[model samples]
Target: MTQRNSSFPLTRRAALAVLTSALAFGAAPRVALSSSPLDVVATTGMIADAAMRIGGTRANVRALMGPGVDPHSYRQTRSDIVAMTRADLVLWHGLYLEAQMEQFLADLGRKREVVAVADALPEDLLLSHADYAGRHDPHVWMVPTLWAQVLEGIPDLLAAQRPEAAEDFAANWAAHKTELAELDSYGSDVLSRVPEGQRVLLTAHDAFGYFGRAYGFEVIGIQGISTESEAGLNRIGELVDLLVERGIRAVFVESSVSDRNIRALVEGAGARGHEVGIGGELFSDAMGVPGTYEGTYLGMIDHNVTVIAGALGADVDPRGRLGKLATGS
Candidate 1:
């Protein structure tokens, strides 16, 4: 596990609490760990970050899939299953985001605490997953507003499993909610500079429906939701034709998916007379490397906003909050 460089406290007492409790309890206190936040198993780093934000000092959040791990195909290892089995609460993005782990999660839900954070988002905000008819998209965390709703769900999930720290979770959740709202406003203001017509966001996969919904861009994806699903020859040709017709110059590659589909689009467009450029890579399913800017949920969106705006000729500032990356920076 990457040492979570969380801004959350890491005092001697907190470290002692993590160390002593973990060792002292061993397998004996697996029951107690479940009742509260001594040990937590989260599917994605984004969800793990949320659990830490709300779980605070009460729990130690562990991500089963770290940076660059494709969640759609990610399967739990034996150790991961052990952690999930022993965890007080297991938080995942849900909405079929974890295609490979869905069955395990269902069985785990029956036995222990499991709450799909993104599952808590209102149905209207999500686009239906193409593979699973009638099910909504699972990548709600891409948009901060939707993310705030997911964060809010953390306390509700903890309320049943870890009643002892309910108040703490509530307070932490409220503060985090405020932060999410602020991030949303900031993104909106910057993204507002992009002209309405130039707001089309073409990317490697259909992961930005929530982003388009939140920020006013017409999001386009080359591939469907599941990276497991291949983009067909006809689909690629169709997108190339669309790109040339639309005169879209730039399309993005996703962090968690291959650029082959996008490269095919570019070639297809070039053959037809349009020259397409690779826009900056976007954090689709996973974040950037740990300790880097663009690693967290907030930084991921910040990077996307800056990159999209710059590539599309938007007037938004290129630099992110911590000077992570901007058009010029």
Candidate 2:
């Protein structure tokens, strides 16, 4: 197979249209099933993590994007193409989350089994992007309950490819679903501790609309839904004014996004006689470093809810749910 150029697919709409046409015409690519351990290639760590949990030892999973890597602007590398092409299955979070790589992935999909896991979610359950028409927010993992619903079918999909391991996959899926339910309950309970009026979650980018909707916090972002969208000085000034007027004590920065804009917000607020502090860095587009609790999907959301609640004057266990938070992370 000839490898395509490893460049960003800036013209996403046109490329996506072609891919959709192929699927509609029944010419979409299909991966050949094999009896060997299923090889899975996922675009983001969160997807890769889910694949590992569901597939267990029956499959090998590889993630193209790691901690602090922003998928919105991520382009495929030469190695990424090789891993994706060789895989028995490929998973990506659709809904324009991988804006830059959409064309390449779509092209790849014409030849193999590629699925946008979050696409399993019903239309009514998704939040429409505020700035882009016809696009839904892709950060569905922020809400554990919503994310669990999206993941429910994954184990079955993997099982279908490797029926011998179906029983193990089913067990893993059930356990994961249970843990996610608990995580959601913990988040809701802890976040609710903040006063209703002061439950404002301001961040560098608008990646937490689902989180805000799931919990009661009002989410404001310096940038639009996609980090690809630019934040202007006017936007900064307006947010700063809101912070001062509302006496918002804490605003957040994102692990994947630059904190330059967040600093501006803090400085802008200071200039106006209001002292605002950076609440904590939230895992918006990526999880924490691997080999730790925060690196996992459960840990990532746990850290977020804990940090948000703690910063906003809520009483939470300092040890956190999993008791593995790095100092000041």
Query: Candidate 1's residue-wise lDDT over 266-305, tens digit each?
Result: 8888888899898888888898876666777778878987
Count: clashes, candidate 2: 2
Off by over 4 Å in 1: 1-37, 129-132, 159-164, 326-329
lDDT of each: 0.80, 0.89
Give the local distance difference test score of model 1. Answer: 0.80
Best by TM-score: 2
Q: What is candidate 2's local distance difference test score?
A: 0.89
> TM-score for all predictions?
0.83, 0.88
Tens digits of per-residue lDDT, candidate 2, 1-329, equal 22334333545767888888878887654422344679999999998999999998889999999999999999999999999999989999999999999999899999999999988999999998658678998889999889988888888889878987899999999999899999999899889898777799999999999999989778998898899889999999999989988989999999999999999999999999999999899999998888988899988999999999988889887557867677554
Give per-residue lDDT, candidate 1, residue 265. Answer: 88
